[model samples]
Target: MRKIMTNKTSKYILLLICSMSLLSCEKFLDKQPNDMLNLDQVFSIRLETERYLANVYSYIPDPLVCNGVNYTPLSDEADWVFNWPHQQINTGNWSPVNTPYDIWSKYYKGIRAASTFINRVSECKECDELNPGITVQYREEARVLRAFYYFLLIRQYGPVTILPDVPLAIDAPLSEMQLPRNSYDECVDFIVSELDKAQQVLPDKQSNTREYGRTSAGMARALKARVLLYAASPLWNGNTDYADFKNKDGKQLVNQVYDQNKWRKAAEAAKSVIDKMPEGLYKKNGTDGKFDPFLSYQYVFLDRWNTEVIWARPMTGDAVRWERCSAPRQINGYIGLGPSQQLVDEYEMENGMSPFTAASTTANPVINPASGYTETGFSTTATKFTKAGIHNMYVGREPRFYATVGFNGMDWVYKGADGKTIIRVELFSTGKDGYNGSNDHSTTGYTTVKYVHPESDVRNGRHVLKSWIFFRLAEFYLNYAEALNEYDPQNPDIYKYINLIRERGGIPSLPEGLNQDQIRERIRHERRIELALEEHRFWDVKRWKIAEQTDAAPIYGMNVTTGTSFSDQNFYKRKITESRTFQKKHFLWPVPQYEIERNTELVQNPEW
Candidate 1:
């Protein structure tokens, strides 16, 4: 861990203290001088201490934002029409010095802040007197948050330097501050142990609406499950590629021997969450009082504090900006974010059969005759979900497909000039939201509808308020199923959990008697569909050691440049939208070059 020297410690602390004061004017008692006295004053008052904790919570990244931190454009799931820094990664134009989506320093700073709060919050003189056990709960929240930040760091950088629970003093000797990166297993153990400690004191759920986004036992357990799952994956577990990768003292950073027991540990971790937490797969009932899969899937995100969410931040950040980028041009939006053809083909038909028996390099996919999917024509009649003359390829698909993908002719349910009208989106060459050789259009002739609210009128400043879910119950189910299949393939619990997600996704349950390999593919595909655009696919492929096949491949989409009209067959043809480059080194992000320069003990990742 790179330590802040004496000269810079005061500046960093002052900045954080000032930011906390800005969060709420009434909470801060007074402005103080920048010194040790001011630092002590912050922890002396109850409101000031709570405000400092809030500052620690502010570092949680907004995955919904289409910035460097966002992973959707970095993966094959989607593309950004404009030139964002995250796109630099797809073209192999980034490095340690020019790293895009770099959160190494950001999260380390968060970890430091959390440690500081954890160590200092006990000094609050008024907290215990005013509210018994409040300071203890606050300290536990900071502990879980610190563990979570470490989890985020390891997921991207792989085996980062773990700081001690007690933050180093600003005036610590330079030699004492420089630290080498911890081993992968050591880091995982430290994070899990911290989460376990926090979970012992935190509540399973926050009953008060005011504490909505605060850390809970459920969040700690969910994060622990995800961390264990990643540690058990091929990237970290017995990966021989890092055999020679070592620290300054010749300590192997990644383990070099396979451990089947790791998978068992991961399965047990996920099962703990399922058995202990009261969360379930969120559902919404239709007009007939049955489980409406489409609404159930769509509103899981739109609905506030639903049972599905294990952890979520309060409705903060500019969610309206994301809605604007995803909306069609007819509703006065940018329409720059488009789903790829590869993702579109991943959705199953109504009967739960995949549309493609095999993927193709050409415009045509190897269609599965049993699935009844076609690319050559339009629908002649209206179906229950789609309208007449819509592309045949988009029709008769699963409920999640309609809930997620905004096709060329899909209706935009928005308020009209008279306050009510369904505007049809036109993504043909000459249509409203089509690729008109502009930066604001959808390059793939499609837009993402998963996170965009149907009634959000970006033109009129009407935005819906909803939490950006960080962890959910569906993820643990898939995690349990995947881990169980690796260690105990014959376990009936595997199919039971997978079926729960499939049922909510409006698809049929898996056929019995699937072998281990078959079940692996099903679990991966389910994750891709269920957790789409929630910042999971990017890390998932890498952890599974399959990014070379998925991320390195050419990104495909509909032919947005050649179509003449809304119903043109040429527009429905698959075309290469972007080409990506992914090498073995791309699996883990490079340690930032500046960090390497600052700490001689710190080593760079494999090739960077």
Candidate 2:
């Protein structure tokens, strides 16, 4: 299956190249009706039809790369050291006209391509003859892909223009192309209905590795669950902020009324996926039959197509670049990606007690004495996870903390000049990976180890190649717990699923008899830790309508500029690294100014 997809991908690339060459030649040659003729030729051939379907699959965003679809750096979870377009977002330097990380045009282009494929795939009689039901599956794939693109568009831009299933022709009138934005609920309903139609025809899972990244019934259901979950969130549900936001015809782009049943719908949607898949959370057990939480949590991203993964891109984009940017300077890496102190503080102690009782911005963090967490002093003794003399701030934390964070003195498993050796990361000013007035250093005084394989040796140019998972089983568990807690806090299923993740992270389960608010906070915290750096934090905060408190707040890290050595206590002191901005308008990114200019009928988001 992998070989077949690879061949198809190559053919698609060749097709694109030929298309581009023909486009250039069209400038010199007489204009004819060749566009339709070429498209007709493409759909009439079996292999060419398959290649076109592969091209539609190519638009699935690359989550591994920070500059593209991944929104990690735009949130409080992590920071990218170099100046990328996403970095400007935190500073409130972007606007509708000057939008950074603008995926509006890119996704709409994909939608048009998918729509065209869906409408024309049946024309390929040769495709059905080659593989009896292949064309039917191909049409379903294209349908779901179109729905997925709409999902992405709404996720980023809130309300968007929902194009018809049949794409507009090249000769379509300009006035006909200018369409108004659909109401938020209408858009959601359309996407959900389309997904349902595709889900009925698509198989539960891809039969072969060749179709690994392609859409399946599971992907459609999982995507539906996410879309419904977002629709149920506070930002979209009863969000009065968008009350005045309407189109030229006074059609409400955002629903003004709140609905509690949306949460139930979200829960049911998530449960549907849970009840269907036999796959569980990916775990690594020791030979003694004991679950190794550290390895289990670490390897979930490193291992390709693990039991936890539901959907992943077959071709990983710039994954090695992600590792190179994450690796320390001592090992010939850029060392730019840094985790925030707020995320570090969110991790529970070995006993499952949160370290900070208050928010991260409190002058003196009210530490949890029962959790045995201390910000000052160094550990005199080594535990199973850390070395002796490591800062108390990093010692005796959860297994996930060890797996995700690269604190000062943490052992980084790497292949050295001779062979594999353990290199302790030095993140002080004078240390190897420390902030040395270069842009390639970690601004937060710490680096990230998540999604970075242990054997990845940047210095030797050897890196691991793995799919960037878009949807996973663990996310559904978190989603289920969150939605259930909102409308059915008393339901025991909430604790059951949340505890499943906690147990996998080597932490104790939640104590019984917690209130609705308490359970909600715990569930949100679980998502923060469990799905860290997986591109959920950014949207999670937005949908929950808490970005003003989290994203706009001052983000902190260790004093990277003042540290003299690895053991310098001044280096360990917490300090603000970046101050961000999040206005009410930030809940949904503004429709690109160019888009608004092109279509006067389109309405910009509120306060853009």
Candidate 3:
């Protein structure tokens, strides 16, 4: 007897047929087959362009949470930090067999999608009734997206073969596709030109609602500044980190240096964005804005068109549904992607100075319960740390520090516990489960609160709705300050921008007469702390060519044994703690052996 159909089964069968067709088509041709979409179908209206653009935002790779086997290694906490089980990385120890990061394919796929959209839209003249300007804007957006993909390539694998347009034939074989890598300079130029065109056609951030969340003139400019800054950094600029640089076309290129002009341009471009970008920061205005910045920051990853998010993938609906596969289980969220101690220590003390060396006169000292001493073994004169004896998890510290971390002694409320308005859990501890010891998540014994949803919030399934700040005002200001500081050093504008970021984060200003090196180091420290866990450290370490130093050896937190006593028990005292360390070779990731084996032109990264 034949069985009647059910809705779910029918849909599954349809999907299975499509998959089979795709597989069969692949076997029939040596080359991959293209989707059945046609130029007419794709560019029939602005809606099509909008939909295609949406694909770009939804393209973040998502892999299930199993044994911490995740996608996009940079985004993985283990890969980003030498914390927990991840400390095993970077030890001259990791061989090709245990290769950690292999991001070439995912990025290439992103590039391909952008290229397809650009090529398709440019060739179609289907905008007769549609605003001619709208078509141009769509094309510009596609170009910017394509440029973004290229920029990712240059940053990740150095030089990569850029296919700016789709192949004419759907079944074009790889043998026929002997495209060479483009020069870093040429690639940068191409991207900059595309961005220039985008700036001309793409609407300003405020005026574009229909094109909301789409790349804007400000975003294009901001990206251009970022690209220029990298080009001007030591890694790309005549530095040994890139001793054997090659372009996409396989041509050798000479090393360049941190050109003053490049820095000036970076500063100018960023300044342009800063001057025009809106000014909005969550202050201590009680209820309304109490958690708004947290919301704004989280929106970078959640909200599609958050004004604060200059550029981000709008991973929503199916994209997010698929993403759920990677989230920690409901029973207990996996601690796979935890933050590192390096990042935790990077946070400034309440006064905006390093806790390690802040001036003891002006800075507040939070006790290191383990040490039982106020100033010993801690940098009271540094930025962002309290004295040794105070509670590490005290409230009303620097706003950003509070915004960024959820420490052990602090009250951490999990959703729906005890039916309390807020279920309070201890973030800092003198025990294993306490905020800072061996079982602690962040290497520094600090857990990140940047992406976490507070217990009181009912929406978002108790999961965070904080948008990842792919690029934001704070970062832009910092970038501008870095470039200007490097270029002019004596400019008060550098101090101005740097101080603005500090003030917003609830930290003190830079002391008067600080040297360029001191200023630069502080700026770097700020970037590391402020941008922690946002997938910026990997690239920042590489570009600065300081991997030999920063990634050269395992980083560890200071060992401490805090005294703990059981209730009604005076018989014994116990100690609780946690620690991690990593090695250097883990700096440059292994070039995927599969790609190297297939393409003799490609060479594996050293010691990978």
How does each model score on TM-score? 0.93, 0.93, 0.73
Which structure is stronger by lDDT: 1 or 2? 1
lDDT of 2 by residue, 260-311 (tens): 9999999999999888876578999876898899999988988877778888
lDDT of 3 by residue, 530-564 (tens): 66656566677777767665554344332222324
RMSD of every prediction:
5.5, 4.8, 9.6
lDDT for position 537 in model 1? 92
User: What digit string (tens of lDDT, one per residue) describes model 1 on residues 219-335?
Assistant: 999999999999999999999999988998999999999999999999999999998755578999999999899999999989978888888865433556688788887778888
Query: In model 3, which range of ten residues has the least summed lDDT?
Result: 566-575
Candidate order by lDDT, decreasing, is 1, 2, 3
CA shift at 86, candidate 1, in angstroms? 1.2
Q: After superposition, how far is residue 299 of candidate 3 from its true place, in Å?
A: 9.1
Model 2 stretches astray by more than 4 angstroms: 1-37, 287-289, 315-317, 359-363, 416-418
Give the number of colliding residue pairs in candidate 3. Answer: 58
Reference-based lDDT, residue 146, model 1: 92
Tell me how far candidate 2 lies from the true structure as C-alpha RMSD in angstroms: 4.8
As a whole number from 0 to 100, the lDDT of residue 77 in candidate 2 is 89
lDDT of 1 at 320: 62
